[model samples]
Target: MKLYNDTNAFGLVSRANHWISAFLFIGLIALGIYMHELPKSPEKFELYDLHKSLGIGLFVLMMLRLVWLKISPNPEQISHNRFEHILAHSVKGILYLAMIMMPISGWIMSNSGGHEVAFFNLFTLPNLVGENETVHEIAEGIHGTMGPLMILVIALHIAGALKHHLIYKDNTLKRMLGKK
Candidate 1:
């Protein structure tokens, strides 16, 4: 199995992170939406805890992806045109930015609200800010607004990938798979 990406395809590590992160992110979005409709109860708290924990995992994965993408550059461009290349690059940039910021905003919101997010119950993240209602409120707002935007960008990214796969009939999406 390939361990690194080439001009034509992604390697094992990148594919692993990409697929795992995608699944986790989908779960997170689903959980977030579900949790909103849930009544105040232990189950709701459990869902929140699960969502936060998985989010931390996704954040770490995104960080690693950024570093990996930098060091292990693709051999060639999959994008056929300047516009496709630019748009794809922009989408990826926004996706990474949103991924990094979402967890951070959630962390700030939790910390300011005096609610701790324990990662898989293994350990709790450090609270960087003091418990302040205003900070908590602001962070909540940022997190709330960012979620839909993230989803929108992700949807567009998926559409672009599908276009490459079904319409373009290229290896763009195949490169992300375990095998090309």
Candidate 2:
């Protein structure tokens, strides 16, 4: 496969970014949900640290994806229907926003809650803001709400992709898969 995107199909970098981010994103969601119910313990703390580290990794990956997109533009939408194209674009926009918002909000929540966000225990990210209850609560609220909404949007995206491949019999999925 080509290493950069072209008008006809996604290239190696884009596909790699998409699949890796998908895996990490889904893993983060599962990890977050599983950890939520855990009682206070050393294991819970370690899990939280892992979650934070993974989240930071995701944030970095997304930012890199954005840069890669700028460097190598994406293929055109396979759908000719205006509504379908618009809807797909909208869902993708929300996904991108969520990808960015989730991690930053989590970091803000952590920092404002007086917790250091260590990236895989190698180093701690600098706090976005000084410790403040209001900031903490606001970040927490955003993180909580965005998490579910992100899941919904992700589901919609997957469904749309399936619709394109299974029903429309188009190259929407194949293009991303680097298939002709």
Candidate 3:
């Protein structure tokens, strides 16, 4: 199968990216939740460090995906219904927004907390903002609160995919499943 989208369906690369991102997104949420629940200790701090690393990795992957999407043509519109098309597009847009914002907020929070952010222990990310207790608190609040919202939106996205695959029995989901 092709790895780039053409006119009929998603390419293998697109499907691969989607599934990889889905798994990573879920893992990130779980890690974030676990870190939040853990008592303040060395272990908690370690987990947070790993979480920060994963966030950086995710951000890089998302940037690559965005560039790929811009250059690779998308699958043809499967639904002619205006409402369905609008809903689909809206969900995609929101998903993209979440993907972009989540990492940024996390990075900002870390910077404001005077923490060094690293990616896979290979390279350090320079702090983009200066340390400020108030800014740190606000950024942390946003990062924590946005977690549940991300989960909700992800659930909706998955539900919509299932609706297309099982209920509607359309190619909409299959297109992203690497089916022609």
Candidate 4:
């Protein structure tokens, strides 16, 4: 297996980033959902802090993933025609936007709510937006509204992978899995 992308397959690094981002994104969403329901308490606040920190980490990962995507060679589609290609590209574009934007909106909400994001408790990120209730509400609206939608897009992405693997029996999914 190659360590870098070629025409037919994704490289190890891309696969690594993709999988890691997926895992973290799922975990963060789950945590966010659960955290919102918890009663006011120390543990709840701690959980919120952790969630915020993980979100900031996700933002960092998105940046690095974007950089890696730009530097790496583009992988080719297995058997996509114009329509399928366009659909796949559209889904991917939206997914990328969600990945980048969700964390940012969350961060904006945090800062607007007068919260400092501590990345893994290592250091506190600067409060960029400060305390703005209107901004906080808007950001929270975006964050909450987009979360479920992103999950739906994620499901579609997975369905596409399954279609490629089970129905088409192509290496499309395997290529992303770093398989030959």
Over 1-180, each residue of candidate 3 has an lDDT whose tens digit, in order, gives 677788888887778888888888889999999889988999998899888888887888899898998989677667647887887788878878877888999999989988889887789998989999999998888888888888887888788788888888888887787665
Clashing pairs in 2: none
Best by TM-score: 2
lDDT of 1 by residue, 125-177 (tens): 98879899999999999988888777888999999999999999987787777
Model 3 CA lDDT for position 95: 78
Report the C-alpha displacement of residue 170, candidate 3, in angstroms: 0.8
Count: clashes, candidate 3: 0
Q: Candidate 1: list runs displaced more than 4 Å.
A: none
Give the CA lDDT, 0 to 100, for residue 109 in model 1. 95
Q: What is the C-alpha lDDT of each candidate?
A: 0.86, 0.90, 0.84, 0.85
Residue 91, model 4: lDDT of 90
What is the descending TM-score order?
Answer: 2, 4, 3, 1
Q: For model 2, how does the per-residue alpha-carbon lDDT over 10-98 read when each residue is reduced to its tens digit? A: 99998998998898888888888888889999999899999999999999999999999899988887876899899999999988888
- Locate the minimum summed-lDDT window of 10 residues in model 3: 73-82
Best by lDDT: 2
Model 2 ranges with Cα > 4 A deviation: none
Number of clashing residue pairs, candidate 4: 0
lDDT ranking from best to worst? 2, 1, 4, 3
Report the alpha-carbon TM-score of model 2 versus the true structure: 0.96
